[model samples]
Target: MQIAIDGPAGAGKSTIAKQIAKTLNITYLDTGAMYRAITKGVIDRKIDFADQKAIAQYAASAVITFKGQRVFLDGEEVTEGIRTPEVSEHTSEVAPIPEVRKVLVQQQQRIAEGTDVIMDGRDIGSTVLPNADYKFYLDAAVSERAKRRYEELQEKGGLNGKTLTDIEADIARRDYNDSHRAVDPLVCCDDAVRIDTTHMTIPEVVACVIDHVEDGTAK
Candidate 1:
């Protein structure tokens, strides 16, 4: 069984998807991290974003490995490295490249084959896992989402000294980039269940998702 959760930045897709994966006893795949790894590689190689061919080639050739919560690119641990604000900004630029998404989507599919997995990202339900057993689109008001992101960054030790307003602005920019990307842009599939998480707590959201999974809403 494959489960897909997709949404804009700060919508709690990652946190909620993790809990859902745990409840379903399946592997949790963070597809966004995969793109970030590729972006980090491209940046490290000093490749210009204007060189689409080079960026695509870099993504295709890069070796990305995941061990539990740890992420490695080209055999180097980059779980936290990819979270840098720089990587975050560059990832949005590269992720929409057709060739880049092609390579990463293929890798993501390979990881889900013959296994029960819950994958979350901006385009999972719309592109990566369109036929997943259960599909969910998590959403929240921009303000609420930004607040959640700010709190999360605070918990992660100030997120490189970024202010809440800075994070909120970043989230807004990401939302636009994700939704307007030319290839496989972020969108909720018609069959997906949309969950407005603006006022819902983590446990409440998880319970709601699990309830749908337990019932016949998604099969």
Candidate 2:
């Protein structure tokens, strides 16, 4: 069984997906993190993120490992390093390239094949796992999402004088870029169930998703 959770950043998909995977005893695939790892690679090498050729080569040749929730890039533990605002910016720039997306999508698909997986990302339900047993499009209000990021970035460090407004504007731009990008834009699949989490607590949202899974399990 596969559960595909599609949502924008800071929408709680990553945490929920991890918990859901633990609840279900399945592997959790954080596809966004894979992209972030690639983005960090490009940034570390001081290569142009917009160069489709460079990005594609890096993604195709890169080794991304996820053990439990920790992600490694090229054998180095970069679980937290790849989550910085700079890496996020690089991700936005490189992830839209068709070649990069193509290679990463292939790798993501390979990882989830023949396994019970909970995969979360911008295009999982729409493109990567359209045939998933359960598909959810998780969302929240912009301010709510921004607040989540603000608090997380504060805890994570490396904000570098960036305010909530700066994060909000970055998120807004990412929303536009993800949804408007020419290749595999971020959008909900018609068959995906939409879960608006603006007012719901974490447990509430997890319970809601568990209910869906329980129902599917019953079938």
Which is the leading candidate under TM-score?
Answer: 2
**lDDT for each candidate structure:** 0.89, 0.88
Q: Using alpha carbons, what is the TM-score of model 1?
A: 0.94
- Candidate 1 local lDDT, residue 54: 95
Clash totals, every prediction: 0, 0
TM-score per candidate, in order?
0.94, 0.96
Model 1: number of clashes?
0
lDDT of 2 by residue, 80-145 (tens): 898888888878888898888988899889988999999999999878987898999999998899
Candidate 1 backbone collisions, by pair: none
